[model samples]
Target: DNEIKKIKAEYVRSFLFENKLMPSTWIVIRIDGCHFHRFSEVHEFEKPNDRQALNLMNSCAVAVLEEFKDIVFSYGVSDEYSFVLSKDSKFYQRQASQIVSVIVSFFSSAYVMKWKDFFPFKELKYPPSFDGRAVCYPSTEILQDYLAWRQVDCHINNQYNTCFWMLVKSGKSKSEAQSYLKGTQTREKNELLIRQFNIDYNTLPIMFLRGSSIFRIKGEDSVMPENGTFEEVKQEIILSHSNIIEDSFWKEHPSILC
Candidate 1:
């Protein structure tokens, strides 16, 4: 029996690949909604942007931060989110598959579980899912660049969608709206919103424009003692919608990479 067990174990183990991530490198796990376009249509998500949907995504991100202490920050837009784990993290022994799968699965389940809280009037039509991938960034600069790229993408897509939806809502067909927006620049889109829709793109909610950023910050936690109450500074997870592409954000929150 010992001989047979040894042979089976070797054969099984040979088929498995650990795919460990590199040490001393930041691990970014990005999760994207699978078939979210159709999911949005089926669920009748609001056009351009949906506050409830965005709120739900942020909530799931907050949950991820709370569960994984090693994750220093997260940035999310639309139906996707990126979680950044500390470079020196030993979570799951730095196995790529394990880390990605666990985070994606948890986010999907959280989205399902918390659906009612954000959309009490709407019924979930089907099980929503997400796909995840893990990538390693060897330096803080590269990681910041990656995040900046996502934020820029969010801005571009949101601007286009805002214009497209506005056109559609004003009696233009979807095809016509697409044609009108095609090849238009950022400035043109802003002009369109103001000229045709009387909407100032800058006046939109910060969350919609800049995307959501989740990170840990030092905050006060009130503690009750027999003598009196005192405030203790502790790390608390928070969500914000601010410009991360600039040096100011990093300068202010230096502990994120440290």
Candidate 2:
């Protein structure tokens, strides 16, 4: 019931911010779980291999999506599902809260029915390891960026690999590496950085170390050497890593692996 209310509040908040709600408003909603928990009696099924557990999570997502079909386009069911509204106008603005209310009710009712079938109420507790929440929302540029990054192959470039890995590692928490990179100061530099690190790049290391080919280098402050010395390049590469680590964003959110 509490969770349901929380979701309802989120829906209201989203609608209020969007404003201009008339009809045919396009929106995307997504929901997913962060972790999985099994009932005490289902301890044997607690491991990640339990198909039944996976199904239950999927079922929850499906139920939410089905109930909101009129306002949603497609939903991705994983740890989260996304809903894209088909219309461009917001005719359902007034009912936004009600929509969320229905979703909450659906979640509570579904959880009760599904959970009771496998274990007693007293034994029912979220699996000890799950920290994820089911989330739904309209599409945002952030989502697009995330999808694009996910599609890229990280293995081809060491810098790209490192940055990608760092993003994921940091993403385990709520810190905003993606947004920080997208910010104005770092946007252009970050773009070049990503390109140089991408698998398609001709010389990933050269691009990574030289920095000038990728970023502006001026005098002693420059990341690369005009003389093209291997030792200088190597030192620069090390410096780049250090600079990335010391970045205000990265520093605030250290890599989980580190």
Candidate 3:
């Protein structure tokens, strides 16, 4: 039996390829919703920006941060999120597949589990799914650039969606809305929203404009009422919608990179 087990283990494990992330480099596991458009449509999600859906995403992200201590930070918008693991992390021995799968699977399950909490009256039409990929950024500078790129994407997509939905709600067919928005620059879109819809694009919620950033900070550790002998510091996860592309955020949260 031992000889047979050894033979099977050697043969089967040999077929499994290892995809280890680069050492001394930050690991970014980005997960995106699979076919979220149809899911949203079937679930009757509010167009442009669904507060409940966005909140649910935020909650799931918070849960992920809480579960994975090695994940230093996360940035999310729309139906996708990018989680950044510390460069020195040894989680799953830095195996790209394990890290990506575990995070994505946990996030997907968290979304499903927390759905009812956020959308108390609405039933989830189906189990929402996500796809994930892992990439290594060799330096903090490159990681910042990657996050900035995602945030910029979030801004652009949000602006377009806001305009598109506003036009549709104003009785314009979806085709007409698309045509009107086509070839229109940022300036033109803002003009259209103000002139026609009286909506100030800048006045939109910061969460929609900048997306959400989840991370941990050192704070007072909780203790039972009777065990007040001493106080200690502990890591507490927090969510923010501030501008991560700027230096001030990094300066304020210096421990994130450390």
Candidate 4:
């Protein structure tokens, strides 16, 4: 009995060494696909935006939101998604390692498991994986800044890709397109897309440009017409591609933060 107890105690005690994240702070875990460039090529994804691939990613994010109640919102672009936990959440005691590991594992597994549903004819050559890291935001301002930074990155990358592809289609060599685009400002790119390609930058699909945002909204309680009985309804997760940087978004979804 003494030897058995010692073994159990030693193993159990080791887990506690991983520290929990600071409480009352917004915890965001961002996960990105590992080596997705090669994965996309091997799978022959459609350029600019692949509808099936993006849907598969969104489905995985929804699964994560359903699995973890503490995650109030999520924003994803390309091969990466960022999940935000409410400031007051105590899920898993905010244990960073456990939280990160569980989310990444679940998302990666879901991507693999649900591939068939999204891509019926295509084959999944092998399992795809993701890497995740958690960061604690001390204030809403800082959190918004982080979110804004990501959105800016998405804008820059999408604009560049749009120009590069248009140039390639317009008979410019890949290296020529690369050289021509180097050091060109955002205005130049928009003008090029307009004058040369006849593609208006503003008319692009919002999803491809802005990426995806997923957040929950509370449901209003309902009253029965006959008996005057009241019933509560479950909240819902809403997926959108609207601007998240402005005050209007935070004001509308006040429950997302805390």
Best by TM-score: 1
How many Å off is the CA of 131 in candidate 3? 0.5
Q: After superposing candidate 2, which stretches have Cα over 4 Å from the reference?
A: 1-25, 32-45, 71-79, 88-91, 94-96, 117-123, 126-258
Candidate number of the best lDDT: 1
Q: What is the lDDT of residue 2 in candidate 2?
A: 100
In order of TM-score, best first, we have 1, 3, 4, 2
- lDDT value for model 1: 0.94
Model 1 regions more than 4 Å off? 220-233
The sequence of per-residue lDDT tens digits that candidate 3 reaches over residues 48-159 is: 8898899999999999998998999999999999999999999999999999999999999999899899989998888889999999999999999999999999989999
RMSD of 1: 3.2
Q: Kindly give the number of clashing pairs for every candidate.
A: 0, 28, 0, 0
Ranking by lDDT: 1, 3, 4, 2
Candidate 2 per-residue lDDT, tens place, 84-117, comes to 4444424255354544445545654675567655
Q: What's the TM-score of each model vs. the native?
A: 0.94, 0.34, 0.93, 0.90
- Please give the lDDT score at residue 13 for candidate 3: 93
**Model 1, span 91-155: residue lDDT tens:** 99999999999999999999999999999999999999999999999999999999999999999
Candidate 2 residue 241 Cα shift, in angstroms, is: 37
Candidate lDDT (C-alpha), each: 0.94, 0.38, 0.93, 0.90
| Candidate 3: residue 137 lDDT (0-100) | 99
